[model samples]
Target: MTAPQTAEQPVYDPSDPSVMANPFPIYAKLREDDPVHWSPSLKSWIITRYTDVRDLLLSDHLSVNRLATFYQSLPPADAVLLKDIVHYLNLWLAFRDPPDHTRVRRILRHAFTASAIEHMRPNITEITDLLLDRLESGGRNEVDLIREFALQLPAFVIMDLLDVPRDMLDDFKEWSDDMAVFIGGARNSGDKYERAERGCRKMSSYFAQLIKERTENPKPGFLMDLISARDEGDKLSEDELIATCILVLFAGHETTTNLIGNATLLLLRHPDQLAKLKSDPALIDSAIEEVLRFDGPTNALVRVAAEDHDLHGRQIREGERVFVMVNSANRDPRIFKDPDRFDITRQQNRHLTFGQGIHLCLGAKLAREEGRIAVERLFARFQNLALDPSEPPEWLDAMVPRGTRHLPVLLNG
Candidate 1:
């Protein structure tokens, strides 16, 4: 049963610009008043409390296969137009339930092993330095960190990992941006489906060709590994291979880009903490964790109920959509002391930015390494780094992914 609305209760609307800007206040309100409230605006049950969101993510009753539910909810015409989008999304490991999820995850685990990520550390640093070198050579004191450094570092690192040519960077960004609108659940983007479909077509076609070429002449890289990865004599089908490549290409850089950007902005906003990090460079890891808890790239994760479940006197029926509000839970007063404060040295931090349980982000280690190295080198390179006074940071008007659209900063501050 849905909770009754009260005048004091703030409505949960992601489309609202204010909400998009800073949803924590409304998230706090929802967490206090109705933790498991059904929102008519989004037509999905919004789970706010830390425990509720955590348990649901770790629960078997909730499935990550929500794309089909979304397709069904759309008008027939729109659904038909997004058929290819659904097809590719369905093949993604993120959208599958075990034993499909279990098998693919096993294969991927071998590829993203700690040693593999650690081996890339040097390359990550090289890419970071290369980007900073370019920035320094540009002779521009003012730069959009999001565009110039943060976004490029991860994209290049992932490209190098996959052995993708450097020339495809711009195309990948364009395609990734288009798909983000749909995948990230941009509430206000009316043409999201069309844009995403176009991205999907181009991306899938490109990967299909790449996979064929790689299969013909084997290479020693991540893409080649995906091409030949197997689990207990089982391997990914052709379609699955293409889908996994796209997932790796997209998810590989998007969140980490946001992490770098968000971490930079947060540190700039809290100079005390920024100075603390500068003094103790080892605090980079803890600082990254703090940034995720404070304002992580992923705001929420969508899941669909596989069976009826009751929580806090609210019934979530089967097939109904549920959004586990990660940003809200990270700030739950019950969970963290002074949750709002940006503290790098904080201990026992367990933010759900990478999610939990079976669906925990596969590239977590890679992202952490990328963010730590990127931020560490960035600050090390520009000791006087500061936000540009003329242009302020702008947050992406997105619901699922929390990131700044532009983080203008004075490089030589």
Candidate 2:
């Protein structure tokens, strides 16, 4: 493949539509030409090698405290506008380091243990069936799968997990999307930040009230567990509790939605692989892993240098942002043979789609099962699941947590 040719920066820009659609070629070029090159466009060092990406993911000096980076660069006006949202996001486990991260993760780990995930399986299957049943009832040969199924399935399931009322799903979804604009690490206009601040206020208030009510009424579910959960003599602070609630609601569905959407699109694009999986249903788990490696949800994991360091023979100053191109690393030639190829049965498919080390995604298990079950039920319900020729899939103009804006597909009744 030809290398990306641009005068502005040799490295590919994440905003480019072509790059967003298919980044492997650019990633391959970067991996070959400048494995640790600094990019003017991204204003950070781009790490493309799989080993470096993996190592940095587990690096102690490189912190995941991105909110600090975000705060340092915040304009006075945007700071005022985004303070509430930023404040809450600062409390997210993803943005924390060391003892703080340990505290929150330990408390919440109870709610996401193996037994918890196992218990959630039947409900997830039931939800998938119910969604497909609804689609069939709609009587449309062509449907926007992202909107009709992929997006809603996770939202519904997460709400159920949180014991949120069914009627509030729409409101929660709106709030969730607004918060994502800020969380996805995508550069947006001032208006977007305003919307996110509003979302932050509304969501925080909503969850705070919910937590308060649960304290008195004592509901049964994940949120209730979090409300009452304790670790030694320490318990979740009110801010931490509210932040955790928002984190679970937002992170829970958003990543899964992208996973389902990206995986379905990849499968539709590669019918042979889809057919292979159909013939051997047991391959669904491995197929999901390949989907993650091929085009996983998150575009990049942002970190900052904790101290002055030399990486790959280049000097990286302390506090400089490093964009770990996960999408690129998954396709690095050194790690996976035929790295660019989409093979479902690829063995030792150790992908960093869910990240690595201390900050591994809390909802990884739930997200994986949701994707597996969603794919199985989706294809099982329709003999012919092909992309809609009437419209092309519109990819979201997002940087992190990449996914399609809309995916229309044709299916048999």
Q: After aligning candidate 2 to the native by TM-score, how far in Å is the CA of 224 from where it should be? A: 1.2
**By lDDT, who's the top model here?**
1
Minimal lDDT window, size 10, model 2: 1-10
Tens-digit lDDT track of model 1 for 304-403 = 9999989988888899889999999999999999998999999989899999999999999999999999999999989999989998788888778889
TM-score of each: 0.97, 0.95
Q: Clash pairs of candidate 2?
A: none
* Runs off by more than 4 Å, candidate 1: none
lDDT values, one for every candidate: 0.89, 0.86
Encode model 2's per-residue lDDT on 1-413: one tens digit a residue. Answer: 11243564356677788887777788888888778778767678788889999999998869888677777688899888888988898899988998999988888777678888898999999999998999989978989999989999999898888878767978998888787777775554446887799899999998898888888899777777888787786788999999988898898898899999999999999999999999999999999999899999888888888888887667787788888989889988788999888999999998888899998998899999999999998998887888998899887766778789799899862
